[model samples]
Target: MSGPRIDPSLYRERDVVPIRRALLSVSDKTGLLELGRALADAGVEIVSTGSTAAQLLEAGVPVTEVAAVTGFPESLDGRVKTLHPSVHGGLLADLRLEDHERQLDDLGIRPFELAIVNLYPFAQTVAAGAPAGEVIEQIDIGGPAMVRAAAKNHANVAIVVSPDGYGEIRDALASGGTTLEQRRRLAAAAFAHTAAYDRQVADWMAGETGQADRVLRVEATLSAPLRYGENSHQRAALYTFAEGRGIAQAEQLSGKEMSYNNYVDADAAVRAAYDFERPAVAIIKHANPCGIAVASAKAVDPIASAHIRAHECDPVSAFGGVIAANRTVTLGMAEQVADVFTEVLVAPDFEDDALAVLRRKKNLRILRLPADYRREIREFRQISGGVLLQTADSFDQGVNSAQSDSSAWRLVSGEEVDAATRADLEFAWRACRAVKSNAILLADAGASVGVGMGQVNRVDSCHLAVNRAGARAQGAVAASDAFFPFADGLDVLLQAGVRAVVQPGGSVRDDEVIEAARRAGVPMYFTGERHFYH
Candidate 1:
């Protein structure tokens, strides 16, 4: 089944190739004029297609239309322009090989020394919510073909795919030609560009045809290089999907460069804060919320009040933590936040006065979230062998599939809670989802008074929550991310004087837990849904 192998010695090796002729076709015309001028001044023959030819002619650069060289009209609405043998023959011919040179000479074809090509705006068109027909039209067939042909023959042809390399290409041409090393680098970049373009097209078509799960092609560009990863010794960098949303796209207004841990904690804080409808604030450390709170309905300064209450939950842990606000940060919030040794503050926006106050902290990072920011539905996690994918845990899918509807909950023990107590239970339940597995949260008056997360057992989480809350644990409602397997964890919360509890009740010993709650004279509600964040 294998084809014959060719001898590598048959082909000639080239180091630097002079630019005697060039082909130009691009959708993104950034720096095209400058490049064309440089090529024309170098006395290089310019052959182009469609708009590129028109623009070069308009700029007083002599150009030969691709159709003229191919001896065929550009038919099929310009899609067939560069697919002919003449184009590929020029691009793919290895001038160093006598066979390829003789074939080109016999066919009266001139080989191109360089190719400048950028594909159509397929990704941007799809992202703009364009219609299927319009999006399909943006898929460039000829461009990728020519790019691949030129890249495969990089020893003879230099392929330029991005305008970012225009200055270098121009300088290289002025210096006589592109070096073999430069050609190799450009070929690598050209192939990457085409691969990403094909991925976007494949992803869009798969989704449109209802075969999205059949394929997964993840593509991202390097955004930044971090100082270190989780520790100083580990190396790391940030790669973005380039969707112009989420923490990857958040604008940093001030402060030191974000570290690997800072981005992780900041993203967690944003997720926790935005989970609630009211003005809310979340202070997070090590990807776990140290404190979280929402503003009361009648609060004068909602965001400020939320921050003050959130910080009170566990001020010691909140120190050097990342803070995220659902609402804009105002002067009142910033003034109080300035006193804390915070690492980062993220919000949708910040008032001028607030920015002035927070900017005084030299080491505090301030980030403004994108205007169209929203939580992504799909989540990906890497393991040792492969990767894990799942739908993100969302508050909107809680209980009866209704967002924070207390009526959907089943009160299995004691008397029903009043509206205020019900609100606290709802707040606690939503907030608990942001915590890691074996999570326990205690809330009162719309604020988290205690939080215990990342524990191995439920009983230890209960004890930790109570210890953090101290006196505040009395009369506070508790929310568990999962059901209590035994009565021991429930007993700990009851001993702390927790007035009510909420959890997904599906354990075989649910009866024991309910009986324990009844004995403590506290109410317990079952959500019939568990949120286990690993």
Candidate 2:
């Protein structure tokens, strides 16, 4: 059967609605008493459910229980208290329609002018490592129902989903009542709140069930609006999720606002800095590391020495670049870098004297990250149509110098490496992982002498590395991001005094490459896995 057609003239928007009755149910009791008192002073009736009614009564505010309005007893552990016709009918009534007004009067239902609700702590419970049964019990059903119903009738009802908006709600009611525009804004906020809650629950359940190919639904709130994107003409903003701490969450104590290029280079710098256990520093230009160095065992001031070595690698390119340090920034290191024009500096901490010294540079950004910051985070990239998701490149963390048994490497030429040479080789391999392919790195004495990256051919990269290193290339170890397609690449490194090499041996001409290293008397090892970052 079809219902009677409604006239278009009957539907009209209400500019402001006076509060006659309201439904207030919340798990978070913040600002409840204040809102309740404001409504009471305005001569509005307050209806609540469960312990909320008890709290309002204790606060000397008049309240009507939800069960009393529905004419039914609370059942199913208080879950069935607000899922009745009286509540929905009041919330969904069309205030401008004559037929709707007659139906409400005949059913003895009073329309609700406001709905204040906040859902249960399902996300918090899951974060605390609760069991499945306990986490499932925290999901609220009737709360979302009433919230959606009130949001649908936003023309007549005002909705508030967060405690931060209580002041706005109070001022709106005090200045007469809520306007239509205010109600519409509140409605939009209510929908976003529910959507984020549901996404957290879905992601948790998918992980528990071992669903590998689950759909990725991200809900991020705006953190900041940048001055511009990669270019001056493009617009951009920053958004953050509810989980994990990274460069986005770092504390910026002093400096100007961050630009889009600053964030990109800062993230890449930190990813390389966090891979080493010893005190180290990485100087990044654009998105690639121009210089990388760790402290030597016998240095008096290891952190300062590392900074000097890194800065000396390519002083021209290091100007106005982002720098990352695994240890604290000290006065000595600050003095060493005072002459260069650095745009940003990130470290675990900064000494009191060092901070004061660096503050002289008015435009330098200084960030203090958490001590235990790591790179074991999920990565996402946006393309033309959709997003690509994968785990970050963190296998470098498990690489160790002394424990050669864990590596899938086999010595195929020259002789086995000593302890010190093996250590430098491990450092070189981890540093190469952060550079863009085709990548080649040379290191000696726990510091990178030269690095060649973002080149098209492997032979050109070797030439660049050798040219940068000059005399320092002698007796230095080398690491390649992938296997050499031809033996000439290995021969070039060997001729430049590269005594040892580490790379993923998987090319069809692996035998030929091994023979070339054998003739040059250079030891070579294969890691079985590649670490190309393009």
Candidate 3:
């Protein structure tokens, strides 16, 4: 399976490789014309394929078609134009190796000092929801072959894969050609480019053929290296999917760089805020939501009202927390937020006056979400030796789904409450999903008044929620992320005078829990679904 290998001693190391002849084939023509002119002005012969050749010719840059060198007409809809040995031999030849040089001379093939190539838009086409046939046609073969060949022989040839390198290549040529170090860097980048392309194709084909589980390939480009991770002792950096749209793509408008914990809490806050349909806000600390609330439909300055209610849940914890809003941040919200010490504030957008007010606090990190922000369907978690992948905990399934329709819920005990209490129960259920398990959330008037999360036992979570709510628990509705195994947790909420409760009912002691709620004269509904977030 291995090809012929040349002894290392047979070839000499190159310091600077001058471009006498170049091959340019590109799908992205961003800097093609300028690069072509630079090479042409340097008297470097340009050999191009199909559209690339036509583009150079139109731009008045002398170019020879690849078919001219291969002595083969364009065939297979231009798919076979550059696959011939004449093209690759020139790229792979090492002039220092007399054998390679003699073989090129015998075949009348001129060695190329440069190869500029970018593959077809395979990832873009897939993301655009193109059909299978069209996507297949974009899986480039000849381009990757030439790129790999040139990159492998980088000691003799300089490979340029992106327009971002055009200026450097031109500058190097002006200084007497690209140095070996420059060629090596370009070779590394070229390999990465081809690797990402192949990953996209493989992943897409896996999905199309219903074999996603057979193999896994996760690829992301580095965005930045943080000052530190959760602690100074840990190291961390941010990596973003090439075609992803999320917090990593968010624009930081002001303040210092984001830390690892900041990104985690900010993402959790955003997810919690967007879980509601109305204007909403979420305050997060340590990847857990301390408070989340949605404003009434008729409220004026809705976002401000949501922020006030959310902050009221636990003012002590919200002081240095990360805040996220589902809608635009306004002047009203900005004024209130300015009074508090906050780590970060993220939103879809901000009013001019709001941004001006927030800018006064130099340490507060403000972020404007990307225009195409969206929630990812799949989630990944790294374990000791492997990764765990699953569908994200979403509100698009089970009884209490995205519509937040309470009609689908089963009332197990007491009388059904009024419309207002029903809305509060639904709001409580949605907000609890953002909390860590065993989770408990209390809501009143579309705002969270209490949250107890990350507890080892459900009973402790109940007591924590009741204690946090104080007098608010007297008439508030409570939501448990999962079913109550026994009546002990339900008894804690009942003793707090909670007016209503909602929990997924699938416990062996469900009957006992229902009996307790009946005795307390409190309405309890079963959603037949759990939202554990650990």
Winner by TM-score: 3
Q: What CA RMSD would candidate 2 show?
A: 3.1
Q: For model 2, what is the C-alpha lDDT against the true structure?
A: 0.87
Off by over 4 Å in 1: 1-20, 29-44, 55-62, 96-103, 121-139, 167-179, 204-211, 396-402
Error of 1 at 98 (Å): 6.0
Write candidate 3's Cα lDDT for 33-72 as tens digits.
9999999999999999999999999989999999899999
The estimated TM-scores of all candidates read 0.88, 0.91, 0.95
1 or 2: which has the higher lDDT? 1
Clashing pairs in 3: none
Weakest lDDT window of 10 consecutive positions for candidate 2: 397-406
Q: Higher TM-score: candidate 1 or 3? A: 3
Cα lDDT tens digits for candidate 2, 177-245? 889999999999999888888777778778888973668776677999999999999999988665647
Error of model 1, residue 83, in angstroms:
2.5
In candidate 1 the C-alpha lDDT for residue 317 amounts to 97
Clashing pairs in 2: none
lDDT score, candidate 3: 0.92
